[model samples]
Structures are given as structure tokens and as C-alpha cells.
Target: MTDPTPPRPGSRAGRKASGAARRRTASTGARIREEGAPRVRLPRRLAPRKSPTQDRARETVEAILEAAVDLFSSRGYARTSTNHIARRAGVSVGSLYQYFPNKDAVLTALLARHLAAVESAIHACIPPLRDPAVPLRDGIRRLLELLREVHEADPRLSRAIEQQVGQMPVVPEGLAGYKRDHVATLAEILSTRPDVRPGNHALMAVLLAAVTETVSVVLVHAAPARFGRDEMLDEAVEALCRFVERPPGRLS
Candidate 1:
């Protein structure tokens, strides 16, 4: 066979080059699919398509959201795909897309839903502090307990959402609004309590909000074994009560 026609003048080399090129292309395509898929284009518009007027539709939305949260907390945002969320939700990808545009949209919706739940919980727990019948220290403890419950719902998911939001180029305006509302609510509650001598309700509210949030996050997500949950709560309550209920003329 004449030595196979001298291997067709670089045919073997060409085959090797083409094979490498194909692999390179495949690798590049995979990277693109992983990293360059659509992100949260409109973070603000992360609402379900039809508002889920029907009970079943609402349930579907909840399922999708819960599945997204589990995936985000466990698989991570970068690794979690819309398809995975849909699969976990037990809904078709088309149905998932009907509600969420992409993975980021689902994250945004989950964050919004979580914050709303927190707000509702805060309203339920903090408002009772406004009652004169409730002792200041007791009220503080109750608020702390309620917050602990909220944070405990899914600490891993909460932390993951926090990190994802932190990575954003801009803070969500709704989050800022929530903070303002919480501060305002706390200020009103403190204003009602005669024992609280903070002198400045707004400042006191801000401080309490900061302290409670920091403590809750630490206790729920990263508290050491030595610092048990109840111990952490007690310490946090003590700190807040002290800060808000200082002796008259003691605060500068």
C-alpha cells in the first residue's frame, strides 16, 4: 500500500489538531453555559407571572420558591441552575420560567418573600412591646426570641441569600425600606414603654435593630458550641435592655 501514501502529508497531524480544537471548543462551551447564563436582569421585577390567584397556583409558586431556597442553600447560587430548581420543585422548566425568568429571579423572589415573612414576624412580636403591661426586658426578650425563630427557619439559606445580595453591585431598595420600617416600628414600640429612657427613640431603634440583627445572625449561623442558643439570646437581650433602659441622665 506504499506505506499508506505517506500518511497523506500531515493527515495524522491534522487529525490531532482537529481533535484538540474540538475539545477546546467543548470546554469553552461548558464554561460559558455555567458562568454566562442569564443573570438577574430585572431584580426589582421578580414577581410571579399571574399573581397566583388560584390556590393551586399559589401552592405551585410556594413549592417553586421553597425548592429554589433549598437548592440555593445547598448547591450554591453559581452551581444551582433554573432546571435544577424546577426539578426540585417537581414542576416543569417551562412552569418555573413562567414564574421566574432565571435562577437569579428566583433568588430575588425568595429574598423578597423571606423579608416579608420577617416583617410579619417582627410586626407580631415587636408590637406587643408597645403595651405597658409588658415589661421592657420581657418585651426585648420576646422580640429576640421571635427573631431567633425567623433566622432559624433556614439559617444556611439566610446566610447564602445575604452573601448573594452582598455580591450585587447595588443594594436592593426594598431592603433599605424594610430597615426603615423596622427602625420606625421599634422606635414606636420603645416610645410606648415608660421604662425605656433612651431619650431618642429613632437612635435607640437603630441601635436595637443593629444589635438584634447582629446577635441573631451570629447565634443562628455561627454561634460556638460553648455559646448555646439560650445563652446567646440572654446576652443579646441584656445588651439591648441595657442600651435602651439606661438610668436617667446616664446616656450622653
Candidate 2:
């Protein structure tokens, strides 16, 4: 009778088949990586096709951006398309193209708008932080609260923009300036505060800012059900306060 068994692992045929399978797997992985890599878009390609000068044009652009935010937030960046955005916006694909060159360009515009709002809110908080009456911890708390509010404005959209930041050019080109400004401003304010330890104010500002942002983003998205917002905020405030108030300790 003919053998009904498949090739055994120890057999030469099995080894050959395994080797071919490994090669195919490797080729597939390479192709997937290539396809998944972020595309380097040229500046012109990312820029809007035209500025919205008229009231009607501006309204159309706003509608498109709003639609993009809704779609990108609900469906995610990968699933959302330019056609979808235009349709949701109640505009023609050609109209959206007139304002945004492509989907990435729409994303860039949304990122810009969101960043501008955040930057404004941050700047507004800086004046209060500089107030002589405001305690260091209190000022920090106020700033953190403001950041949380801004982030909460459109949490889903904010998360979506953050997720797609790597694929867009605006982050490095536009966001860098805003970040530098915030860092410099915070450093300056920290230097003036009498309670702050007399070390590297710039580094301190960076740490404080980073911690606040990280904590806020985490709490907004991945926070546990048991942990309330006020509880998390209090913990963050205490942690940041201790870092700035306490002197440097030796590493064990």
C-alpha cells in the first residue's frame, strides 16, 4: 500500500520545503515593511493648493477640516480617504483638493490648527504662572489643568493626530517652533521662581513639561477605571512638585 503520511520534519524533502517557506516569509515581511514605511512627501505636495481668500472659500475649507477630524477620529487615519472627507464635508472632491492637496495635507492642516489652539492656551497660562501670588505648585497645577482641558476639547481627534504625526511633515517643520517657544518660556518662568532649585532651569522646564504632557495624555486615554481624574491630577502635581522642590540626590 502507498504511504499516506506527509513528509516528516527530519526528511530531506521536508527541509527543502521549510527553507522555501522561510524564504517566502522573509520576502513577505520585507514587502510589508516597505509598504508600511512612512512616505517622505515633498513640501509642495503637502502644501495647500490655494489659500481660501473669500468667505465662501474659507467656509468650504473649514467644513473640509471639520469633516476630516470626524472621519479620522472615528475611522482612523488608514481607513479614512480624501473622498470620504469631501463627501462628509458636503463638498466636491475637487473642492477639497483645491484646499488640501491630499489626505496627508488635510492632516497637516488639522495638526496645525490643533497645535495653534494648544499653543495659545499654554501662552495664556504663562502669565498666571508668572504671577507673584501664585505658588509654584499651584501655578504648575493650573498649567496642567489648562493642558488637560485643551487636550480634552477633542480627545479622539487629538489622539488621532498624535498617532499620525510620524507620517506628516508639519510636526518637525511647524511643531518644533511652538515646542521651543514653550520650553524657553517655561524655563524663564522657572528661573524667576524663588522656590525652584538653583540647577539647570532649562532641563527642569523640559522635565516638568514632559511629565505633565505624558501624564495628561496617559490619563486621557489609558487611565484605569479605578483612578479618577482628580486623583491622577493630584498625584501628578505632587510628583512634579517633589521633583522641583527637592535637591538632587545621589544615585545608589
Candidate 3:
């Protein structure tokens, strides 16, 4: 019999078989991840998986957050005791305390959750906008639209924030990085014009977020008939755009 020899690398059957093998490997890996199975070492494909216990932990955390929104937003953080949150969540006070130290801690977590959701919406809305005159305008409009939607969807919480502006929860840990990066992005958008370096962009970004937030809070309180959401958004975006475009030494 002739010696069995390896097929050439370019053989069609070999290529087909290789492709089929890769598909099978990917399917198996996806299944393993879904089932939370222990990772199997393989040169072709490997991935980390979230185990069963991880799912339960996630549920518990989310339940606490929901309870928090109800308690803090409805009753205010100071009045919403740990026991109240526990009962609302259908979990033991001990369990509730395990995730949070005090009412402040719970509020902190809630703020983080709220900030994360807002950031996600902003991420979807702002990006790759190039024009200095119109980019900020469009970006601010999108941001305010998202804010109005979020605020209207939960008007009670929004009112709570409005009524207790001074007591608004302190910005959470690790949030500074997000705020910083976000500011940098805004600055970059504003800096496309002459005489502005990328290095100075961050300051502009910070100013943008701060000014927009202040304007948004004001807009939420004004009469809807006159300064309706869209009108308010337009005014705010226009003001911001003009501020960014102001000629040097034009402002007193």
C-alpha cells in the first residue's frame, strides 16, 4: 500500500474540515459559558465564565438597588432606615446591611447606578461628532433628550432631587475617572478650532458638563407651557454652543 501522506495545506477538504472544527469549538465554548462550567484549557479557544452563584449574587444586588430607588427617592435617605429597605426588599436587615453600611452608603450605590445609566445613554448619543459649531449643539440636544426621558419616567425621584438639591448624594468613588474622561471628550469636541490645544480641552469639558447640568435643573422646574422640554433643550444647547464659539475677549 502507498504510504499515507498528509494533505497539502491548501487542500479544499482540509480547509472545510478546519472551518467546521472552528465552528464546533465556538459553539461549545458558548455553551460552557452559558452553563457556567469550569473553563477548559484549549489553544484554539478559551474564555472565562460566570458561575451559577454569580447569577444569584447579581439578583440580590439588583433587588437592593430597586428597593433603594423606592426608599430613598420616596422617603429621602435620612428617613429611610435600613429596616425599611430590608422589608421593602424582602431580605433580612442583616443581609441589607451586608451590602451597605448606612443610609448614605445605600444612596451612594443608587447614585452610582443612576450615573452609570446616564453615562450609558450619553455614550450612545455623543460620538464622532466633528463640527465645532454644530457638534456641541447636537450632542447637548441628545443628552438633554435622554435626561428628559429619564426624568419624566421617574418624576417622583426627579422631584426628590429638585427639592433636596443640597442633599443630593455625594458623587461615588471611581466616578471621577468617568467624569474626567467625559470632560476630555467634550473638550476635544470644543477644541477642534484654532488656538485651543488638546491639553486645554479637559477644562472646557468640565465646564460644559457643569453648565449643562445647572441649566437642566433649571429647565426641569420652569413652566412646561412656555419653556417646554424641547424649547428648554434648544435654548440650553444654543447657549452652550454660543459660549463655546464666542470670540476671544468678547465677554466682559
By TM-score, how accurate is candidate 1? 0.70
Q: Show where candidate 3 strays beyond 4 Å.
A: 1-60, 131-135, 155-172, 193-203, 246-252
Local accuracy by lDDT, each model: 0.68, 0.72, 0.56
> Against the true structure, whose TM-score is highest?
2
lDDT of 2 by residue, 150-190 (tens): 78889999999978986654554545466777888888988
Decide which is better by lDDT, 2 or 3: 2
Q: What is the RMSD, in Å, between candidate 3 and the native fold over all Cα?
A: 18.7
Model 1 ranges with Cα > 4 A deviation: 1-44, 52-60, 168-175, 248-252
Q: TM-score order of candidates, best first? A: 2, 1, 3
Tens-digit lDDT track for model 3 on 1-252?
332222223221222232353111222222223221112231111111222234444445556656667766877867767776665654556766655655556555554445556576667766634544444456667777776666665666655644543464443335435767777776766677542333456676787788876776666666767766777788887777666654445554
How high a TM-score does candidate 3 get?
Answer: 0.60
- In model 1, the Cα lDDT at residue 87 comes to 57
Q: Mind giving the per-residue lDDT tens digits that candidate 1 earns over 1-252?
A: 312111123112222232343111222222222121223234445544555544455546766777778778987888877777665665557878776765666777777656766676677776568887877788778877877787788988888887898775555676547789778978887787788885889887898788788877887877458777788888888888888884667555
Of candidates 2 and 1, the better by lDDT: 2
Which residue pairs clash in candidate 1? none
